[model samples]
Target: MKIAIIDDNSFLISSIKEKLSFFEEIQVKYTANNGADLLEKLDKDHNLDALLMDIEMPVLNGIETTLAVKQKYPQIKIIMLTVFDNDENIFNAIKAGADGYLLKDVNPHELFNGIVDTLNGGAAMNPSIALKTLKLLRNPVDFKDVSKEEINLTNREVEVLEQLSKGLSYKVIADNLFLSPSTVRKHIENIYSKLQVHSKLEAVQKARRNNLI
Candidate 1:
């Protein structure tokens, strides 16, 4: 029944701790502010049985942390405790090897049950999340599409990429967009750097592949 809590918000950490305090079987081992902190702490002392992980965090997020932790400590169970119930977040967390998914506002009894169920080799998902998981199974979301946010290209950059994808020359692109040729060239250079490509064709291809254009 030893567990660790990882969250960026100190108040939420305290709240989770308070909820678990009612259960004598659950021992709160340590608290971490983010995934990096959690990893560092685990490196020092990884004698815990499970973790209550928060999704949105600084440095490293819950999903990334879960993947890392599971790779290193396969025996340690991980339960995602977060405010988000969106399909994308839940799907990503599950894909990252989460043993359970529960909302932050879950009742103490239900939260304790989720922890126990996860530790007992059962998946624990909130009711809504469970339905979402079923739907996800029925129609799987493309993970590549889920990762498009990582690139985070600006709207103008996407517009420039779209124009470039049309095989337009830089001068023509500039004229069509009402910009100078030098500005278009600079924009293309920035796009190349952002897309990690050497040429217009590669940039366009990568952008299309990532669904950014």
Candidate 2:
């Protein structure tokens, strides 16, 4: 997979490159010190499969870079790299359309796995930041606008949506439902499209509004 690495720390960049070197399928096609350099490189070579970007940098931070890339090259997946895991940073990064978030201290194999997972259309929140991400978007028990009378949700779909709202992963939901994770994901995709939403938070709120769960 074609990839780009953007960070202010040259040594860290080199280390990541060396780590990823074992994966013959993965290639570090581009490297940038900051967002500006990343953008410049993209302007010249836009065939990248994913971008690994740092949260803090000299010219532009990872959040802004993600927003810019999402606005312009919406197809390119972005994996945020950070040494610090803060709420504000996570919130901003998610709002800016980050596909995944990873700490600088991640093991090489996990990092490669995260990249592959993202390429295959899945999110890869760093274990250190997953709880923060959950806190960032997880729904409270008292969801507003729930209908008293059930409004057409299947027992299974309601169960799925409930698990989704509680932050149970697709795999976990599938395990709970005795269905495949891919099937669960399809259900979610259907749920999102039917709800006219993009993210999990929006789907849960809309489902509550329509009394789906």
Best by TM-score: 1
lDDT of 1 by residue, 81-150 (tens): 9977777788889888999999999999999999999999998789999999999999998866665646
| lDDT computed for candidate 1 | 0.90
Candidate 2: stretches off by over 4 Å: 139-213
Worst 10 residues of 1 by lDDT: 143-152
Residue 148 Cα positional deviation in candidate 1, in Å, after optimal superposition: 4.4
Q: What is the TM-score of each candidate against the true structure?
A: 0.69, 0.64
What would the C-alpha RMSD of candidate 1 be, to one decimal place?
Answer: 10.6
Inter-residue clash pairs, candidate 2: none
lDDT of 2 by residue, 1-213 (tens): 999999988999999998898889998897999998999989999999999989877678788899999999999999997876756667778889999998988888889999999999998777769988787677432222323424455577778899998989899999999999988988887777666668886678558646677
TM-score of 1: 0.69
Model 2 residue 105 distance off true place after TM-score fit, in angstroms: 0.8
